[model samples]
Target: MKIKVLIADDHQLFREGIANLLFSAENIEVIAQAQDGADAIEKAKHFKPDVILLDIAMPVMNGIEATKKLK
Candidate 1:
């Protein structure tokens, strides 16, 4: 099965770029994109992705805080 992934970042270009890169891999799938940590948490719960690519500095909670909550 493909590895499901969620990408969270405040920069749209960076997010899409990463998604494109991941998409090139046959064993990976980009499941969702989140703009901030809170959104990442929500998407993580809903999507239950196998991997999450998060930006450390973001609005509405930041990556570290979100990672703790997700854990």
Candidate 2:
């Protein structure tokens, strides 16, 4: 099965860099990206990615809070 991934980070460059790297992997796919914690949660709900890489701090909500809601 494909390894679906969602990137959640306040930094655009960091997110883009990781996304680019992941895109090179044949088995990995970046399904979506979010700039903040709330957005991340919303996208995660829609994307249902296998893994979500989130930064510790973000606007609207924090990664910890987002993770709680997701769990």
Candidate 3:
């Protein structure tokens, strides 16, 4: 099965770029994208993606906090 992924980053260009890269991989599927930590949490809970690529510096809650919550 394809691996569903969620990418959370503050930069729009970077986030989109990563999504594009993952889109090229046949085994990877980007389920959602979040612009901030809080959004990441919301999306994670909803999507329950197999993997999450999160940025360290994000608005609202930051990556570390977001990861903790997800854990």
- With candidate 3 superimposed using the best TM-score fit, by how many Å does residue 35's alpha carbon deviate from the native? 0.6
- What is the number of backbone collisions in each predicted candidate, taken in the order shown? 0, 0, 0
Flag regions of model 3 displaced more than 4 Å: none
Q: Tell me the lDDT of model 1 at 61.
A: 89
Candidate 3 clashes between residue pairs 3 or more apart in a chain or in different chains:
none
- Candidate with better lDDT, 2 vs 3: 3
lDDT of 1: 0.97
Which 10 residues in a row give candidate 3 its minimum summed lDDT? 59-68
Encode model 3's per-residue lDDT on 1-71: one tens digit a residue: 99999999999999999999999999999999999999999999999999999999998899999989988
Write candidate 1's Cα lDDT for 23-53 as tens digits. Answer: 8999999999999999999999999999999
Off by over 4 Å in 1: none
lDDT tens digits, residue span 1-71, model 2: 88999999999999999999999999999999999989998899898999999998998898999999889
TM-score of each: 0.98, 0.94, 0.97
Model 1 clash pairs are none
Better of 1 and 3 by lDDT: 1
Ranking by lDDT: 1, 3, 2
> How does model 3 score by TM-score?
0.97
